[model samples]
Target: MNYRIILALGAFVPAAAIAQDQPAETRDKTSAVISVGVDYEEGSYGTDQDIRSWSVPATVKVQHDRLTFAASVPWRWIEAEGKGTIVTPDGPLGLPLFPSETQVDQRIVREGLGDVTLAAAYALPVKVVNLSVSGTVKLPTADEGLGTGETDYAVGADISKTIGAGITPFAGLTYTMPGSSEGYERKDGVAVNAGVAAQIGKRATGFVAYQDSASTSDGLPDGQRVATGVNVGLGGGVSLGAYGSAGLSAGAPDLATGLRLGFLIP
Candidate 1:
């Protein structure tokens, strides 16, 4: 599953405003943020085939003027089981070597470092609207069998407008270049997402978003998801956030939940 992609998108959503359109005088010349979070997800690929994973991710971001740099690293545990049929030279064979015809059951459990991600963004602020562009790189860091073991690259652009009392509506589009490792074939793809954020109280904001991505490989289905979340500011430059998402397509995870705690420094 594309857990890293989801995390990257989540990181950008709430912080988009802070990095984009604040008034010049109120903005800090240099600032940094550190965050730690956890994510859980389950995916069902077919009947009797399913996978579950849990991840703990930590991120650091630094901003100067209109440019921002960020990185994230995660530790992940994954468990998967499936029953399938395999074809042999002799003929189609049932798995598990059962007396009766039945599919074979295979299972795996692994835990290790997930992929590491590095990213940069630049924003152009205007009176009523903001435009930003970003690029990201993914490094293979996990065990070979547990990770893609390939470097990935992506670039995206976002446009947002704030209107009517702290309500911001934003849209973004991204294109990714996939990489391949031994025994693997990767394909390029595109993603689009849109959302709106609204101030709920003096120190809280809420948002809802939708995202869709084209299939990145042959035989894979396109994916879609919807998410809702809130960020609450605590005293002393600390904040808390929670979010949940549901899949709208066969290729997406059935459910995902996440929580984050963050600190900012000026």
Candidate 2:
């Protein structure tokens, strides 16, 4: 089977599913708010796999009343030490150091603008709290094979509902397009995203979210991921944040985690 097919399915489906039932709303012109956050993560690529890695992802968001937007760019470096088998036309070939084993010695390093995502959201005035819907597109800025297998673009919608206690639950999905740049084949598919967030007291906030990239294409294995982190409000309108996530299944790699810490001014 071809990896491109897998990449397409794994990348596009879930976004389609989540965006189908969203309601439109008026744009907000309240106050323009800005936030910046950074995260750092480190762990073995998978279960007991010999590969280990770390990353620093930074994100920024701007929001007014009915209108909101966000962007994130992550820089990563990986080092591993494990044996992996690579298949060939003749048969299954086992390379003692195919995957991570030999890479660690040479300090295989991959770093760049992992992926650039841009999103816009509209807020709907509900009774007590508020509800918002959003859409995003992912750009293929990183090397899929050498770095992370990020697709070309995705379109989807998100819903954010707030409760009495400053707690909100958000869910969304997007359609992704795999890059068709020659050897860099990726499955174009739908990806689903969901999460919850809350304000802790007066100076802190926390959130947890998950992304399932399955339906986009059939060429690659299933991609399931989760993320969680916290942010704190500093005096003089400044803030800091950090978060991380790991892949549960999807034999693509052992494990991939991330962390971020940064400051934002309101």
Candidate 3:
């Protein structure tokens, strides 16, 4: 083996060992939390080109007496080119007097409400287990011709079960209701998502998750999409998280990515 490889491995060993030396009970906690986060992401708004944006998301959560309630609001400011037609490919093509370059220049600045979520969870008096029902409403905040704002809603349930070694596995189900759009009739669909998070070191936790939503619109094909993300706790109820995912099927477009720095308040 190369000497450089040995040196790199030597440097990484201590960090890994320190991460694994955390106590189990130190990571186990049940507390009500309210968090605010900011993210910077560069991706396609509704097309193939890259669009960069800064987002603000604030979440409030409470878990007590075997019940949980939470809400999240996200606001975004986007900057890019060639993202005009939104989820549809017709707006640019439909204009007889409009040129492609003209549409690209005017479509750069786009802003609106991203996704709002509300959730309710109940612990069944069982050890290390809980069940939750959540609903997300996508308001018509983003412009239709320049963004994806047809207004949709989703209802889902989440199950979290704890096993050995401080690992919890979670699964979720969602039903989607389509929005109003010409030539794009509403079609209902389902989504399934699963994830796991584990304690790392004395003050950190890490996680990965995947989710697939059914095709609810004829405008796009029906298929599966997978997304994975990671989070690291920075102690004092503060954490840094980052996630990026690409489409597993044709229905997915413009590999989505995001990073968040969050502060939790008790």
lDDT leader: 1
Task: Give a tens-digit lDDT track for model 2, residues 88-116.
Answer: 00000000122343423333344444556
Order candidates by lDDT, high to low. Answer: 1, 3, 2
Please list the Cα RMSD from the true structure of every candidate, rounded to 1 decimal place. Answer: 7.7, 9.6, 10.7
lDDT against the true structure, per candidate, is 0.64, 0.43, 0.46
Query: Which residue pairs clash within candidate 1?
Result: none
Which portions of model 3 miss their true places by more than 4 Å? 1-32, 39-54, 79-84, 88-108, 113-116, 126-129, 139-151, 181-184
The TM-score leader among the candidates is 1
Backbone N/Cα/C clashes per model? 0, 44, 0
lDDT by residue for model 1 over 1-266, one digit each (tens)? 11122234353232222234445774558888898998887776323557777878898988888888888877877766665521100000000110113567777666777677787878766555678788877777665444556777777787777778878787787787767655445577777878887878788878788877776655456668888887878989898888888889876667888888989897
lDDT of 3: 0.46
Order of models, best TM-score first: 1, 3, 2
TM-score of each: 0.84, 0.60, 0.65
